[model samples]
Target: MMMLNIDDSGMARPYLRENIVFNHAHTEISTGTTLFACQFDGGVVIGADSRTSSGTYVVNRVTDKLTPLAKGIFCCRSGSAADTQKVADIVRYQLDFHRMQMDRDPTVLEAAVACRSICYAYRDDLTVGLFVAGWDESLGGQIYSIPLGGMLLRQPAVTGGSGSTYIYGYFDREFRSGMTKEECAKFVSTGVALAINRDGSSGGCVRLAIISKDGVERRLIKGDCVPRFSIC
Candidate 1:
């Protein structure tokens, strides 16, 4: 009689256990769409569409993706709503604790590293993408894109989610060096609006966060605020 052995591939030489059991893995597919940020002359402009979807279903129409992770830093969440919120809370808590302990605020890069550490720890289990935008005394203003596993990329302009494919061209054509804060804000708003128009997964009102040397400003760009025609 020949002996059969099963390897890592789960294949047997001939006969395997008829009762072999396969473990089931639970996957929760939740995501949001259309988040982008850009740097202007003196500040950074971050914007996102307020749409949350679970697989094919629209879970919420009014969701805020842009959140303040630290006193001067803002982040946009794009995947797994619950995971995003929970990660944001964790990052915020860590930032707060760091500030309290050091008696100083964390720079956007430092904050990114901190958040990335947390994301790295859960790289295998969590699905989350983030963009960190803020003003730094040393670095001026910047935006850092954080993908799964906490890989961080400093970008002058970036977009995440399915809608990113549609808006990158628009952003490339409209974005330029040394744009004013207002110009950056308009560009972000228009890019998000265009995403909502084309990407079925992206819709609802546009939210904006302007982080500058002075402070951070939040506003909602309503329908009328979006230009009827291209503003570029």
Candidate 2:
């Protein structure tokens, strides 16, 4: 149940990792990678390549990268598995609290704030990187990203990871705002193509999810993929 962690003063805190053992539902180990999220005029498009690394070598290839929170929001992670699930758990609990207290689903902004707060709870060692996408009618499909230990950040869109710089470069050149769902999907396809190509740790499959008012629209896995989406 213990993993290595150096505290602020370069002191080891075995308890931080040991405190939450895998025996209980409190922990789940995960390794992840480049996730794509785009919000368009109609809804949201989220794409995550199935690649994971334990160290420098590929460890998993057919991983599910995106998880829907509700009718309009989704979350993705690309870091330590234990930390990411803890962050997700925070989201689940907070949403429940808000739904009962405020009488509405937590807004994307509110969710971002909550997630980022979770990231900071680790201070420095257990930080999490998140890509959040959803429908903010006023913004009409929005993309926002948070860095490790980040606070409230409002971006039109974002990408994260050791390969983030490369993904962002692709996004800057390829991402199109105010797009329709079709255009957004196309844009996401292009982004995934770039990530899988440049990020050695990303590949095997892609789980694509689209979000709208009605609900989330999921795409076929690689084998069942239709034309371009399955090209990998």
C-alpha RMSD of each candidate structure in angstroms: 9.0, 9.1
CA lDDT, every model vs. true structure = 0.84, 0.69
Quote each prediction's TM-score: 0.83, 0.75
Give the alpha carbon lDDT tens digit for every residue of 52-73 in model 1: 7766567777788888988779
> Model 2, 229: alpha-carbon shift in Å?
14
Worst 10 residues of 1 by lDDT: 19-28
Query: Poorest 10 consecutive residues of model 2 by lDDT?
Result: 223-232
Runs with alpha carbons beyond 4 Å of true place in candidate 2:
1-32, 136-140, 221-232
Global local distance difference test of model 1: 0.84
